[model samples]
Target chain A: MSRSTPLRGVHESLGATLTDFAGWQMPLRYGSESAEHNAVRTAAGLFDLSHMGEIFVVGAQAGEALDRALVGHLSVLAPGRARYTMIVNETGGILDDLIVYRLDEDQYMVVANASNYALVARELADRVRGYDARVTDRSDEYALVAVQGPRSAEILTALTDADLDDLKYYAIVPGVVAGTPALIARTGYTGEDGFELFVLNEHAVPLWNALAEAGKDAGLVPAGLSARDTLRLEAGMPLYGNELSAAITPFDAGLGRVVRFDKPGDFVGKAALERAAENGTRRRLVGLVARGRRVPRHGYPVTREGAVVGEVTSGAPSQSLGRPIAMAYVDEGALEKGSLAVDIRGSQEPVDVVDLPFYRRSK
Target chain B: MSTIPDDLSYTKEHEWVAGIEDGLTVTVGITAYAAEQLGDVVYVEVHSEVGSTVAAGDAVGEVESTKSVSDIFAPVGGEVVEINSAVVDNPSLVNSDPYGEGWLFRVRVEEEPEDLLSAAEYTALTSGES
Candidate 1:
């Protein structure tokens, strides 16, 4: 059975199209997904991210346990800092991408994707068996809502007394928002300035209503998963199943810099990841821009000189770029020549080989 | 709910057929219900040419949204007498005015159409679907 998020009632009352995503009934859109995408790019948009997982690791050796389990240097991270890291298997395959926030001296929170959080929590629990840390999956107790876009800070600053100006990007602080306790994190997946607010599940409705009221004139719409997917795509960020998978590693997806071998102690997949660095990947991910309106979707074959050279992973008609763009895993041969075309339903449409980040914020 | 005009006939495929009283020359397009589910249409491609033959339930065109693409099926069998060049050039009309300016093709009927639903029946089909 598909579970409902804390804000499911609000979404239904607003006439959203609810779809089953990753075992949860989530809102696909409010009305026009393109408009929601544009709103986040130009103004601000609200997102119900309660379906995301929040796992806590608390103890004297919490940071040490994370360093041994993942592929990042988490021990040296400051209290207010957050680091984006990943958990890999013994074969150096990526399990899930995570964000670890050091909340206090003995406390750290690991934010995970809804689809893989259970497995990630289990993995963390098992990895910390000998350590002086305890892993707890507290996803059910918290609710998350994000206000994203260029005008997010202005809108959020109105509702909270916290020092929004002093809060740098990738930093987290505990504060009260709209009369509810929340962890304000200056991080987002949309490649825009935004804050992910984590509060008690019962406080979700009031917080959403408050943000909606505060950002009424600033064009803050209740954005859904449809717009979120496209916004992240425009930013060239990878989704778990689309770009990063159990069969693919960080090195293959052009995100090898995330794995830090220089960190102390033996971490999981360290040996295999070291070999991946010396010998480059066989198939690499590249960006493809369609010459026409045909959207190059996932699993579509990419060809070069009449031979299959790659496969499309994630694709959509980009509203920001006003063209169809895709990320594909191509053979090393195609990556070398930078020449390829996507076979979109038996027709070979030529694609311009471009570097990722199809659209960028002014910053 | 989308508007289902009582004056027109519909297919289970969610297309509206019109101009039937004009001696077998009928105009066809996807109904407003189908357009809403498709989100914002970015591209439209009609496979039936002005003189090509089409059959009912055949995929004669393609409508693409940002996240997905759906095939536009022919509601009735006929020779494609006309294609809407306006919709081909500008696909957003499919969402803006699906039954009027967004009509996909016109057919010179080859035989009697099959499985055409009235506006009430089409309304019943889409009422609790979304």
Candidate 2:
């Protein structure tokens, strides 16, 4: 049986379609996923991200431990700030993309994808063995709720007195929302201004209800995993299983910037990553805009003149572009030289190569 | 619960057939239950040409939604008389009014369908599955 989140009852009350995702029974959508997607772009959308894992690494050398365990230089990150990083194996293949938050001088929170968090926790525990820090999997004790979109700050302002204006992007602050303590972070996967609130499991329902009531006039709707997927795809975010995997390195995914070669330490994947950086990858990740209505799905072959050249990683019908969009890893040379098409169920559908992120919010 | 019209017949694949007793032609479309499961229809295609013969269990077309896609099967063996162009242009019709404006195609009856369920049977099937 799939595990249920703390707000499963609330989701059922709202008539959501529950689907098993990453071993958790989560809401896929409340009503129309398109409406939820639009709500996030225009107004605000609430999300129950409790399925995400939160592993705490706390000690005198927490930052140093993370620096050796992951790709980013976490030792230099200031308190109350988060950085996108990845953990890789000895072969330099990405294990999982993570958000590491420096909560204090000797404490850090590594937020990982639901599917790979268990393995990530084990890896961190083993990787930090020599360091003074200790790893604790606090995923079950926390519930993460996110309010995302243009009016996210406004919705949050009604509940908390924290300086939403002063909170920079990728910053987190401790504050009380709806009489419950929460760690409010200005971070989100959707390409919109948003805040993710981390609270105790007991405080989830009330916090969600308070935000819903306060943001009712601001057109805040509860979004689900379906809308979240499309939102992140439009924002050009890479999912764990689709874009990042143990078989693919960060360099192959065109996300080599996350790998910190300058950091002075023997990280797990340091030698292999340096070699990968020196010898560039054969296939590069690119955005594909479908010329036809058929959506290029995961595992679909990206072909050049009937010859298989690459494979699609993630795809969906883009609401913002009014057409279907996909991300695929194709040969870098074929990208510049020849026409490409996605073999969608035996029929070749033409596609145009575009930059990452099918949609971006105006600043 | 999704609305299942008592006048129409349903297939186990979640398709509804209309005018089965009219003796000439019947309209076919996916049930509302199927549409709700699909969650936002994006693209729809009818593969059975207007003048082509199709077997009862043969796949005729497909409906693509935001989350997934499902094949639209022929409920009964017949000749494809016409396809709904409106649904082809705007696939959202499948979710908005699945039984009415979202009718997929019309078929000239070639035989009496042996496998079909009444409205009550379909409701029971969906309820048990859910």
Q: A297 in model 2: Cα distance from truth in Å? A: 0.5
Summarize candidate 2's per-residue lDDT along B3-101 as a digit string, tens digits. Answer: 999999999999999999886899999999999999999999999899999989999999999988788899999999999999999999999999999
Model 1 lDDT vs. the true structure?
Answer: 0.91
DockQ of 1: 0.86
Q: Point out where model 2 deviates above 4 Å.
A: none
Instruction: Report the CAPRI category for model 2.
Output: high
Per-residue CA lDDT of model 2 for A90-132, tens digit only, reads: 9999999999999999999999999989999999999999899
Candidate 1 colliding pairs: none
Residues A1-363 of candidate 1 have per-residue lDDT tens digits of: 999988999999999989888999998899999899999999998999889999999999999999999999898999988998999998899999999999998899999999999999999999988999999999999999999999999999999989999898999999999998999999998889999999989999999999999999999999999999999988999999999988988899899999999988999989999998889988988888998888999999999988999899999989888889999999987778866899998889989878888888997
TM-scores for all predictions: 0.98, 0.99
Error of 1 at A148 (Å): 0.4
Q: After superposition, how far is residue A65 of candidate 1 from its true place, in Å?
A: 0.4
Candidate 1: residue A153 Cα off by (Å)? 0.3
| Alpha-carbon deviation at A323 in model 2, angstroms | 0.4
